[model samples]
Structure formats: C-alpha cells, structure tokens
Target chain A: MTLLERDPKSPLTWSGNLPVTSRYTFGLAGEKFFRAIKDEGKIIGSYCKKCDHTYVPASQFCEKCLAEVSDWVDVGTIGELHTFTVLYEGYDGARLVQPEIVAFISLGDGGLIHRLGEINLDEIYFGMPLEAVFLPEGQRQGSILDIRYFKPAG
Target chain B: MTMRKVAVIGAGMTKFVRRAQETPKELSWLATRMALESCELTLDDIEAVCMGTAPDSFDGIHMKGEYLSDGAGAWRKPYMRSYVGGGTGVFVPIQGWYHVASGMFDVVLVVAEEKMSNFYPHAQAAFLTIFDHTTERPLGPNLLWIFALEMNRYMTTYGISKEDIARVSVQHKRNAANHPCALLGDPDITVEDVLNSEVLAYPVQRYDVSPVSDGAVAIVLAAEHVAKRLTDKPVWVEGVGWNLDTAHWTNRDLVYPRYVEYAARMAYDMAGIKEPKKEIHIAEPYDPFDYKALHHLEGLQLAERGQAPQLYIDGTAARDGNMPVCPSGGLLGVGNPIAAAGLMKIAELFWQLRGEAGDRQVPGQPRRGIAQAWGDLMQVGTVVIMGR
Candidate 1:
C-alpha cells in the first residue's frame, strides 16, 4: 500500500453499484390493512380478545398467545404519544433542513411509528397525546404515507 | 442435545478503534495470534475454528466468512462461520462450545471481527436492508428508529425517567476507564453529560449510544480434559443459549424481552442456576445503547421488569454492588465493533473469573458470570453462562 500523500497505491476500495428492485405481496394479513385504509378510509387491526391485544397495521398471528387473529377491529385515529425522537441526521448521512420528528403514535391497542407533524420541541414529552390527520380520501392511496403525519391531539 | 463440558483457556483482542488501517484479515490475524500467544499454543493445537461476524455489507465484502477464514487460522482446518447479528460474538463461543462439548473436536477456536469503518459515507448506511424493504423502508427508517421506539415504549410503560436510564452510561463509562483496551473510557462521564449529549432520537442521545468501532476478539476453547492440561485456571463454559423473536417487531411488546428471557432460562437451567440474581456474580450485558444494557438485565432475570432502572439509580448495579453489570465498561464505555464487542465481553469474563483483570477486576472473587447480546431487527437474544 502506497501513501496517498505520495502516489496512491492502496487497493483497499472497490467502487461499483448494484441496482436492485422487486415487488412484494403483503399477503392476506397486510392486504387487509392496506384495503381498510384505502377503500374504507379507516384504520383496522387484528384484535386478539383472548390476550386482549390489538396490533396496529394488523398481524396474521398473535405473538403472545400464538393464536390466529381472524377478528378485525376498527381503531380510533386518536392515540397517545408512546415515545418519539427528533432525528438530526437522515439515513443518507446528511443534516435535514427540518429536524424530522419521528415518533411511535399509540393507536388502537397497538401502535404505529410515524412522523410527528406539529412540533414544539420544548413542550414534547413522552406521554403527550397525538392524532392522525389523514389526507383527503381522493389524495389518499393504499399506503401508510396516505395518513400524511400525526399531529398534536386537541 | 447433551453437551460435554468445555472451558476457555485463553482470550485475546485488538484495541477498539473508530478506524483501523489494517485490513479485515490483518485484524483477524492479529487477534488470533494474540489469543494463541496468551495460551502458549500454536495453530497446530487447534482442532477446528468457528468465526463470528455481522453482515458482509459492513465489511464491504461478499462471502465474509470465506474471506476471513485464513485470518481466523482456518487454513486447511475444519472451519465454519456462524452469525446471528450482534449476538454473533457470544454465539461464536456457543458454537465452539458445541464443537468441543459434542466430542467432535477436542479443541476449538472462536473469533469475531468487524470493520464497520470500512463502509462508505457512514457505516449505518449499510443497515438499510434490516428494515422491512417494502413497508418500513418506504417510511425512511434508520436503525436508531427501532431503538427509540422500543426505548419510548419501555420508558413509558415503566415510568422510567431518561435521567434514571442515563446512569447506565455513567456507570459503564466510568468502569471502562480502568480498561486499557477500552476505546472511550472516560471516568469523568456523568449522567448530566449523557442527558446533555446530542439527541439522535427521542430519549436516545449521543452519549447514550456506543460509538461505531473496528476491532476483533478471539478465544481458545478446549474440552474439559484438554482444557485442564492447557491452563490450571480454565473458565468453564457452563451453558449457552440463543433465541430470536419475530422479525415483525411491531407485533411484540417492547417493554419485556421475552426472547431474552427464554434464552437466559435455557442457559441458566443447563448451568443448574435456579436463581440467576443470586448466582450470577457479574454480568456483561450488551449495551449498544445504554438503555439496552438495562433492558437486557431485566431480560436476564438479574432484575425484574421495570426494576433495572431503579437498580442503576440506587447504585446496586455498580461494579462493587451486590451483582455488578458490565464490569468491562461494556459497549457503552468500550467501543462497539458489533461482533467484536460481544467477544470482548467474554474475554473480560475470562479475565475476571481467573482474577487476571488488572484494573478492571471486580472486588471479591467472581465465580459465576453471564454475558448476553441482542441483535436482529429488535429480535434476537444470545446468552452465555461461564464459571471458574
């Protein structure tokens, strides 16, 4: 290995790129979550009454009781602030113009992680409440982003 | 499977560093050489070898095991690589323990190495695939997001204050000061310092996280009879167990690590330990994040659910406390090179059990010890039980 200061000869690095793309089918469980939000304009979850547990975005199987969650329940859009973080950096190693407020919004009996829209950094605490502000049904697609972001609850 | 008894005769490691000029093979060779030197053994004495490493993406190589084999002293010898994320470190010994204990090999060498700094831009950029590619990836998730979410859930469920959790950093970093091999061993680190550090994610701060590092650690293991001949102070591998939860982490309760509990129970049962809190004299739980240490402590049954924070706050989890945690400064104080950090904990335990730890030695003889690591997508839990 030659010094870069002189004439570079180190063979330590190889630069190349691999293009990868694929489509995934979310199967029976995931399709329900997407369809519920897309067609019905509502959030749905798999509620295991035996364990009294409901999962956000739905799961095919119950982890705690090892039972199939066939029963579906419509959960409220309003939820509590489970926990959150203000990310100073992005995944690409760049500083963001807006320090993204990432949070786990407690929805249904279970919860989902989403971006917090309205933020007063000083006032944000662990248990602060929040509500999901959805995009108009016309603009909404069968995707999690269709919910736009969660805002501070009234 | 019934396993024959196995013992650790020696351990060696390269100093944890943010970056290393040495290549991955060179780093592995260095640690392997040091391990052999410590035991006064040659490569010829080894029967087989097992290597532990994280992802190929971090090392910027495909077939990471094949590339790392020679450096691990597996040239023309029986060799294999076992990886289960960060758990790969302790899992190395667990795999090697099986080699010797099963009477398949009289001696086995276990090594773990990671060159996280080798990744371009940032080492974390390579972790993108760990998330659900279609669903979660679309949301722009970083690895820290899972930790923050879990920490948020844990803190909220237990009413645990960030200040109370910050004490793990204080305790571990201070203990790391005594460790010569430690990378960030600053005795002056305080809870105030941790709390005041940059917030990477909610409830997670810069000081609360372990630094990314490049390092390697190796250990020489032998069956009971050979081990007795190799070293008079053989640290016996009493038990080993590992478990992985569902990859879909959102489905599970983040407050309790049932997977870690299951893994610990398996190891403790095999080790004949009914009450780990009373029996485990020292613990070196993985602390990639400071909160993880406390989280794993509760999982290991060293502390009850929601009680680990109080233990740290009450000074009950300090080095001189009734049962010490992370006496080797852990990943928080020592640099975390992923797999290497896990093996470093085992090395520390070997030294502690044999009373060979210089400044980092625990007061009173530490006879029984446990080292655990968690990995995967907020899933896997790996545990090892060892004794003098």
Candidate 2:
C-alpha cells in the first residue's frame, strides 16, 4: 500500500483574495472616550462600581463583574508605565528608520497602550511617571492619534 | 448513561436595526444581561456559555468568537462558539442543549449576535466570498442573484406565481407590527405594495428580501430541575437536527431543499412527532426571503411541495390559524441579521410556547413549535423542535 502525500506535480490549486470592505462606528463607549480626548484633551475611563475597576479608553461593561459601566471619569493625562516594548520594524516587516517604543501606561484601575516619546531607550524603566501629549485642538479628529504620545512626567 | 432533559427558561434580544451605535460586543452584553435577569439569574449561575455569530467578515473582526467571549459572560468559564454559516443562531441553542443534556452543565447561556452594518456599502459584499473561488466567484455573483435563480426554479417547478409569494411578505410584515424589536413591521402592507417594490434581481423584489440588519439574541437553557426552579413555564428542547448539502450548489436541483427535509425528519424522529403538520402547532422557518418561508415549510413537511403557499393564501399561517407560521414576524418583517435572525426565531418559539409573546401570541395555546434556519451556499439547514 502507498501512503498519500502532497503531489508536487499536481496543477489543481487556485489562489484568490476575498474582496470585502468595512466601515466601523466607535460604539457607545468608544464615542465618549474619543470625544473626550479630541474635544477636552482629557483621558476618560468607565467605572464599574461593583468591581471597583475603571477601564481605560472607556468600555460599556466590566469583565470581572460583568456589570454595565455608565460612570465615566477623567483618568487625567498622567499615568505610570507598567510595561514596555521596542519595535524595530514596521508591520509589513520593513526595517524602520528609528525604533518605536510602545508601553502600557497604567491609569486608574486600567491602562492605555501608547508610544513613549521624549525619553531615551536606555533610560526607560518600569513605574516611570508619564503624561500625555495632545495635538492642537484644530487638528484633533476624535481619534486615538489625537493623543500624540506619552512623555516622561516631572 | 441517561440523557438529561433541557429546557429554555428565558430569552432576550436587542432591537433589530439598520445601524447600531453599540459595538458587536456591547450588543452581546446587552442581550446576555437581559437573558440572565429574565430568570433572576446572574453570570455566577451560568456554568457554560455558547456563542454564535455568522461570518466574521460582516463585523471585520477575526476570531470574533473569542473577541465576543467576555461580552457573552464567558469570563473564567468554559466557552465555545459554533458556526454553520447562517444556521449558527439555531445551532447555538442546540449546542447549549447538549451542554445540559449531556449532564455536563446545569445551566447554559446561548448567545447569537450579528453586526452587519459594519460592512461598508452593503453586507452583501461580504457574502461574495462565500462562493467557490474558481467556479462561482469569477461569475461575479451576489446572494440576491443566486437566490433569484433558486426562486425562479422553485416557482417554475411548482407552477407558483409571484402574487402568491407576495402574500407571505404582507402577512409577516403585518404580524411584525406587534413585535417591539422588529425593524420592518407594517400593519397596512399590501400585496400590491410588495409586487410594486423595486426589483433587486429578476423575480426577487426589494420587499421580497429581508433587510440588512444588526442585532443580538440570547437564551438561557437549564436542566429540568433548574428550569423548574427558575420558572413554572419551561419550554423544553424536544429535538434538534442539522444537515448540509453539497457546497457546489450548481450540481444540485434547486426545485426543492432536500437538506431541510432531512434535517426536519431527523428532528421529528427524535421529538416523537409522527405528523409534523398536525403535531407541530407553530413553526418559525427561516424566511430571509418571502418565498423561503413557503419553501422551508414544504421542506419541514408542514405542507406538500408547491402547495405550501396555499397556507398563506388560506390564512392557515396566520397568528390565529390552526397551524401558525412565523407569528413573531419571521425574518421577513423582523429583519435578517444572519445569526441573530435565526436565534430570534428560536426566541420566538420560547416565548410563544410559554404564552409570553404578548401581542404576537397565537391563540388556542400552542403546545409545541419548531424553528429552523438555512444558510451557506443554500447548503445547510438547522431545525429545533420545542415543546411546553
């Protein structure tokens, strides 16, 4: 008996790409979160009283308590770096001109992932205090990029 | 090992809409919360969660089942998602039934959600990928175009006319006037209105097709003991059956959906239902298109082939009729949000069987009802028979 294997000589393969496009709404909480950043130049979070947790970037429900979080609070522009990673290449695997430092900045009970600026890679450390840098009000488009990056706080 | 009996204790759904401000996750959460509250239960009480959502392309989210897990109340618990194209809605509850019927979980939460509005221009664009890449895709076929062919075949084979099929839309739309969550409920919709509506594809008019929608639906299933504890009116899951035809739809005869009949037969056998037309008092067949309702009825053996439209003509499919079909408006009036629409039919059965379907309830107290969903290149059929 012969075992079946991939027949390299077979010409029975077809290749194609899915032709689909999409447009997304920011959602209930997302709209509020982005609007706060764009209009007020402030960071907001949805508070779940049951879990005593505040979700950064805002959300409608708390995963821990499975409770609806309607309480919105400004977590302020200040946060502390909880973790960090440096990307040396673009998403397409193209080598970048400069390394990009991305960090998870802890706010209240939750955090935001943003790029760290105005700091040297060798000096970056855990628990470093940071503050957000926003673009000019006229340029803000209710997007995450509205907050340019997180710089080291005094 | 003895199989444990499972029953639906509660069900809930969000309003069907063309566009929703809430994200897909939020929609699932809203439905899940309401389902739990209906039975005075909480996330802690649920032992397992089963999630169902059709093609991720609709929402532009990959691995959507995992993305929607926490929102479905699956945190720190056993959770799984099932997909059978559009059949996911009815299939998810069947998945939940097994969780309890297997004596593995006392209480299970089943959720089905779809956010089709995320697909730009129209959700139909996403369906373009569902076809065979070589054989069907190159022909540039959309869902409406292909279904038009099937509709033509069905009409030609049965010698049915478009006027008879238009009646199904009018009746279902009128019935939806009573459904608070329906998107296209119209009490005054007439046959002429449907016939006059803009034609999308030949033999398939705008009114003949269900609208693209976004929505979510959730149902709570519990074992006999827990269901009895939760509510006096428990709608038992009597039988569930699903079957798939060849993916190469071109090779098959479009005159009849033999797959639906096979699935219905499997369900009837397990349900101990000898005469589906007599034993099943109500039916919620997938009706994404007006003719589909009649097509599925014949497949479910509720009526003879080509004669299913007579049920609508004679008023037997009315809410107050002897054998009511799609009393909750079906997909025609309720809106077709893919997976969510299928689950909506199951939720309707749950409510109608419990006499909880307020203004839409059928008279004479319907004791048993069936809900079926069809999906994929018109290849799969999922059926569930529920009883009080």
Candidate 3:
C-alpha cells in the first residue's frame, strides 16, 4: 500500500511543562586555575612536555601526547585577535544599548574567548595585538570576569 | 558471515515552522503515522523503532530519547535513540539500517524531532550553556561566536572573500523557493542581500544561517526482501559512517573539518566509491551555518581542500549542475530543527532517487546521492549513502 494514502486528520494538541533546575561546582583543576587569578594577577597554562603543547584552561592531560600534565607555565598577558564579532543582543535575548565585541584571542600557545574593550569598532581587524585588562585586586573574583576584558595593546 | 541488506521504503515529515501548536510527542506521532501509512503498513509491521533528537535542553526535558519513544511508535517493541547532537537526524537512519542488516528486525522505523520553540527566553539563548563552564562560559560566549571564529579562520586560510561565502547563502536561499518545507525561501535573494543583512556575527549574517525551527521527520526501513514487497522502488543504504574530533576544539586549526573527511572515507570505503567527485550524483552536507556546507563538502571529498567556496561561484553546486547539492533547500534554506533537518536530507535523497521530489527534483534523474550531518562541539560527523 502507498504511504500517507489518506488525507490524515490532525490530532489534538497537549500543552505541559516540567520545571528543571540544577547546579554543579567547579572541580579541582578549575579551583586551582581560578585561585591563581584571584590570589595573584597571574595567568597559567598546562605545559605538556611530552608533546610540547600548552593549554590555556590548564588541562589535566595533553590531548595530543596523552600524558598526565601537571607542569604549569605562564601564558603571557597579551594575545592576538584571531577574529571578532559585533553583537547587538545580550545572552538573555535583550537588546544592548551599545554593540558587544566578542573575540577569540590567540595567545602564543593557546586560544581564549573573551570580550574586547577600549577599541574603536573600525580599528578592529584580524591579527590586531591585544592585552588582558584585569580588574583591580580589591574587586577581583575567582571568575573569568576577574580579568574583565581584552583590549588593544600598544 | 555476510551482512544482510537494508532499504528505505518510505519517508514522511511535518511542515517546518518557527513554532508548532503540537507538543514534541504529537510531532513525532504525526511523522511516524505518515511513514507507516505511506508504506502501507501498521504498527504491527515495524519490528523496532529508533528516535533521533538533539540536546535535551531544547526540549527542556531530561532523557529526551526515552520521552520521545512512545510517540515514535516504540511503545512495546525494541526501541533506541541515536543522538550525536545535530547529526542524529542522519544517524538515526544509519542506526535503523543496522537493525535490519543484522537480521534482528525485518522492518525498522526512524524518527527525528526538534521543538526549538519549546525553550523559554528564545531558543538561541539555551545554546549559551553549550560553552565551557570553567574557562569559556565566563567569557559570555554564544553559539554565533564559534561559527564566526571558524568562518574568519577559513576565509583567512583559504584567502576566500566574504563575497564568495555569501554566494552560498544567495544560491541556497534562492533554490529554497521550490521547497514547500523551506522556511526562508526567496528566489530573488542576492549576494549583496546576504552581505547587507544584519550581522549576527561577522561573516555570519541573517541569511547565512538557518532559522530556528520546529519539525519532525520519519522514514520506514525494511530488509531487502521486505522492501521488494512493500515498494516497487527502494533506496538502498549503500554505506554509512560517522566520526568525532577532540573536544579541545580551540587547540586545533578550524580551517578544515578532518573528522568529516574521515567519516566520508569510512562511508565511501563501505560504498566502494573511490572517486566521489565523479561517482556521486548529489550531496546534502550539513548546513546549519552556510560556511559549514562548504566545509563539509570538502570533507565529503566533493572538492579539493579550501576550494569548495569556488564551486558555487562557478555554478557547480546548483540544483541543475553536474553535481547538484541540497536540492531540498538544506538547513540553510529549509528550516533547521537540528536532527529533523539532517534526516530531511536522507529523505530528500530517497525521494530524489525515486524521481518523486516534485518541484525540487534534480534534472537528469540522479542515481546516487550522499547526505551528511555534523554536530557536538564542532566534532561529530555522520554520513549516509543511498542508491536507487
């Protein structure tokens, strides 16, 4: 027999909802990474000597060499802008008074995603030099926003 | 020990829309019912059922596969859900092929559904949680950011201009005019129109992306012998392959999707296709983002590395071209309901090979077609090959 052979009648609709909520804590690796930024204005990365690679988020193991990596190295404060976008909307689906600039910053060894600051929209381009702008120590928190945003470096 | 053969006998789908009054279960039921009816079969005919859907976050339900089982026509019989983010649409059919090919089931039903409208505060916002919580989320990353970054890197690496990339949106949206299920079809769209559209992110504009949509799709698969009895013409599943890249997406170069290439190779090897560019008649690579279609085209071995963007400029990928692509309007032109969109590709291949694709049929009557879906943190790639 052929399919959908009959002009099928539409079925009745049902509307319902199941509210769900949850929370999780950052693990050890995250704890240490965040502590370093909060305690001291230092950015560290996991150095994998086996494959000669560095990860900005400080991974527990090297993805390439597959070796346990505890070697922490300083991943400088400055980076290069690989790419950027101007967003007119916020995360909550609300329009922002001013455009937001989101960028992928390429450190020498790894890449970090963050917002850009203090740069003219027209001046932004691929390969533009950038440096992390950390908030004052008194106001620092163990979060990515502690570094505030990345801005064009002289 | 030789493996049994499997064939697709029928396909069904609900109209793609931004919002549907029906619930997820109802959507699945409609599609499944149509597939069964088209194949002239009843629930008793299906030996097993497989459900394919994207993240549970969109549905705002945990254990999405389990929830969708009943409506997918998997109430009591063997049931399973195949999920790999956006690739689940095509992957579900591939998984169903296994049921018949393994001699475990004579007939299998495959269904994919996504109700993006179900999420509160807009569907786009739910994607925010896909970012890394410890390192990346602090940066307030959104879905468009990754696509923009990849698009920038690809353009810079290949020396491809935004105008060249925009051509894909222009061509695909124009082609969508013939697709009844397409959400944003426009025959008069132009390259300039894409460039001038609002920039959600640089290089990715309004037209360069697929709309967030609600849709469901289903296909009935039967063993070779059973297919012969059910339908005069059957689309055989010649080959299927899927691969995943490392989750450390930032650590590697995004210029090329190596995972997709590996996946295509696996499927091609199974299909015994050595020269894809010359052998395959049509293709439907995932196109959630416009550039991704070209990226996957290269991965599918349809064109040389860093060269797919030029195919559209030269009129090579048009529906009437020698190697037509996404004749069903693709996720870019049609609505993108994630998993449903991908399965829609396989459905397109089935209908196209049977010469049943009314207004969107490719000329010359194609014999072989390929469809692919990609998802999961720029990692997973799923491929399926079919022939009449």
Candidate 4:
C-alpha cells in the first residue's frame, strides 16, 4: 500500500554484507568427488551402511543415518533430468540476457541439482536424459561449477 | 479435571510487504494496536505476552523478541519469546493455550512478526546461517538448495512434476487475489511463467517461492470464562502440539515430513480428530514453497501420501472444492513475513471457521478447522486444531 523508494534511513537493507573468499567450496569428500568429476569426467556418491541410502556429492558421514559413510561409489555421469526451471532475473533484480536452465539430475540412487548447460529450455522434459560435462582440469575450481552442468547426452 | 478452554478474542495485522520502510518496532506496534482495538482492550488487559518470531537474521536484528517487546505491548509486562522458526506462528497460539491452560494468565497477547526485507543485498545469504554453523555452514549452500533437493526427492518418490507443483501457486495466487494483504496474487500465471522465473536452485524458481516480506500479526487469547463473557461466536481452541526432529537435515529422507505427522497426531489425538481427511472441514498448511503445501497436506493427514498434488490439480483444494487450503492465499500468495505469514494462515482459519472469510471462505459452515506451520532446519512442526 505504501511503496517508498530506497532511502538510506530505511530499517532494512543488505549493503555491507558480502560473502568473503570462495562462496562455492564443497566439504571434505564433496570437494574430492567434485574434483574427480572435473579431472576424470566422473560422478561420485557416498553410501551409508546404516541407512543403506547413497548420497551424491559424497559425504564423510551419512546425514540421515548418522553412521560412517566411508564407502565411495562412482556414479555414472549420465542421468535424467527430473525437473527444471529457467532463470531470467538475477538475485538482485538484474535481468539476464539469456535465461539459464537449472535442473535436478537424478543419479544411481541419489540426485544432485545444478545448472543445465548446452540445452534449450523448451526442449527440457521431466524424464529427458543428460550427462555431466566437465571443465578442463586446469580450470577446475573444485566447486559444483567444475562440471559446468549436466548437458544433453550424445 | 481438564484444562480451561481458550478462545481467540482479538486479532490484528499490518499490511504485508516485500520490504517495509518502518522499523520492526513500528510494524509490531501497528499490529498490536489493531489487535487491542478489536478486542476492546488496552495494554493493561494483557497480563502476559507470548511473542513468536522466525529467525534473528531476517530483520538483521538479534534477540529480536526483546528488541520487539515494546512494539508487542510487553513494555514492562510478564513476557517471553518463543521460536520454531517458521513454525513460530502456529507455535504462538499453542503457547497461549499453555498460558491459559496452566491458569497462569487469563489473557495472553500472542504476536508474530518478520521483517525479512532487512536482508537487502540478497535474502538467500541468510540461508547460510540456518545450516550447522560448524559443519554445514562451512559449505556454501543456499536455502533454496535444500528446498530444491527436498522437492526433488518428494517428486521422485511421488511421481509428481513441476507442472503439478506450479498448479498450487496458480490456484492459491488466484485465491489470494481476494485477500487484501496478499503480495503475490496473480490469476494469470501459467506453468510456463513459473518455469521461466529466476532460478535460485535447481527445481526451485523465483515464482515457486514465497516473497520475502515485512509484516506483523497478533491474536489475543482468553480463557473460557473470559471468552464466554466477551463474544458468542468464539472459536474454541481444541488442541495444539509442536515437535522438532534431528538437526541434521541432510541425514533424513526429504520425501516426507514425519515430524509434522507426529506433531499432527499429537494435536489430532487431543482434539479427537480420528479422520482429518473428513472430520476437518477446512485446513491451512505451511506453504513457504508450492511443494511445501502439498508436503504439509500429506503430513497433516489431510490427504493420503502422494495424493496432495492430485487434489490441487483436480480442483479439490480450491476455495469451493472438497478440502480448501491456504484460503488466505497461503504464504505463496499472501506476503511471507516468515513468522507473520504463518500467523496469517491461522488468522485465515479463524475467519473461515467463523464464516467471515467473505470470498475466501470454504463452501459451507466449516465446523472444524486446522492450521499448521513448519519451520526450523526442516525440523520444527506446529499444529493447532480449532472448532466452533
């Protein structure tokens, strides 16, 4: 009802806050597995013996099972897109020239969500298959972006 | 042998917003004043105050309850703040029930507020604080990522899709068009619109999420004797319950909110609601995201497992449908001021149960209604069962 323009005196704002250093670093096993994807063009997951559920972007300990998840499983890079969305607006209201396609790619027993690359937004379907495409090892940053995103399989 | 019955004697709220220009104190004062006026009572009438707020960072104000006490009319009164993050709204009423149920106070003024607009640069950054500060926060993960993951898991387990989930946004926003305080109500949205919105995380788009908001809501609760003397159509507080799960969110299966189910069971048992699907005429479940509404619907036993999305698609959850939900447009349509958003749902349930919801009311005289709110690191769930 009362729309006021941005005033410095306004009680709410996010001016000085900034995420210092790297904002995308994964944890222990997550970092290792993500690096493997970048250097070896492979995906990996962690298995919890107690829960018997595998976790992607491998974790040292099962979050649900709360048990040791030391076993590692290399997930195939190829998977199907379970769901997706296209982004036209950046976080701070900046308009994007080309919408980015983000999707959840389901792996062997678990799934990982990421930005979809080299794909048309309209062409994406619920069950469409895709594969992870890695950046060159030299350019790998050990982040989710290391793989860029799951692209259409050949 | 039983505890004293309680009734909501007053209710008030401020205009919901994506970002408010006023300070948290000013916003809380606005709603607190409105509530006192509705109840024909002054600050002196409230013997105690129970405040509920979602998080400390949303407003960039820490120990927010104490910071907000003056605005909530707790200046020098016996007061305490309760939090279950998003669940704080429903949790407030439950807190009030205890105050009255314990005979500690005949009148407890319950207030909920969230000034999310305070986090200006990008609200997503607040997500970092919700994680295990020691273990999980070290990893850069946004709040949307968790919801997206949970939604992905829910969809996988239930065979649902983005279209099915978007249908909820479309329907609720359409319903919200009638709510005066709604912030994101749009009847013209298509699944394409939601799909094309900005991506915060995979399976989560800009449109699928509730907007960050600044707002406040309040309700004055009174014991049976006081309620009977004040109004004839008082809605009785039948039952209330809240529970929390393990903090390790990633450790649990995201497909279902078992904590919410357990919380609901506690409330239903106390309320004697054996068949929520049929016994309860109207319902309001938390809906921070479109999928959350469906998830909570299943959790509240309003529908069978995986059957919530189908109800949304079949016009079953519509205002005039078999089981109406989020009639106040939910958090999806109405502004989501976090704590205030959940209370807004409770307010909607109050209006519906009393047949005062105007266009948003369920088809007939809904004798029994339920309002539930979920919060925390996917851990807290609160429920309130009410009947007229």
Error of 4 at B200 (Å): 3.9
* DockQ pick, better of 3 and 4: 3
The residue-by-residue lDDT of candidate 3 on B149-201, one tens digit each, is 88888888789888888888877887788988788888999888888877666
Q: Which ten-residue region of model 4 chain B has the weakest summed lDDT?
A: B132-141
Instruction: Write the number of the candidate with greater TM-score, choosing between 1 and 3.
Output: 3
The order of the candidates by DockQ, greatest first, is 1, 3, 4, 2
As for candidate 2, its interface RMSD to one decimal place is 24.7
i-RMSD of all predictions: 4.7, 24.7, 6.6, 6.2
Worst 10 residues of 3 chain A by lDDT: A1-10
Off by over 4 Å in 1: A1-23, A46-55, A60-80, A92-94, A107-109, A119-130, A137-141, A152-154
lDDT of 4 at B19: 69
Pairs that collide, model 2? none
Q: In order, what DockQ does each candidate have?
A: 0.34, 0.01, 0.32, 0.15
- Report the C-alpha lDDT of model 4 over A1-154, residue by residue, as the tens digit: 1112365654444465434454544567766686676677778888887788777657788766568788888878898876655554454555567766666677755666677788875686767889888888888755566676788998
Alpha carbon deviation, residue A41, candidate 1 (Å): 3.0
Error of 3 at B301 (Å): 1.5
lDDT of 2 by residue, B1-388 (tens): 5888899998999999877778899999999999999989999999999999999888778899999998899999999999999888888999999999999999999999999877754677678778644223433456766677678768866789999999999999999999999999999999999999865555777788898888999999999999988799999999999999865454345678899999999999989999998999999999999999998999999999899999998989999998998999988898988999999999999999888899999999899999999998788999999999
Native-referenced TM-scores of chain A, all candidate models = 0.86, 0.86, 0.81, 0.78
TM-score of each: 0.89, 0.72, 0.93, 0.78
Number of the top TM-score candidate: 3
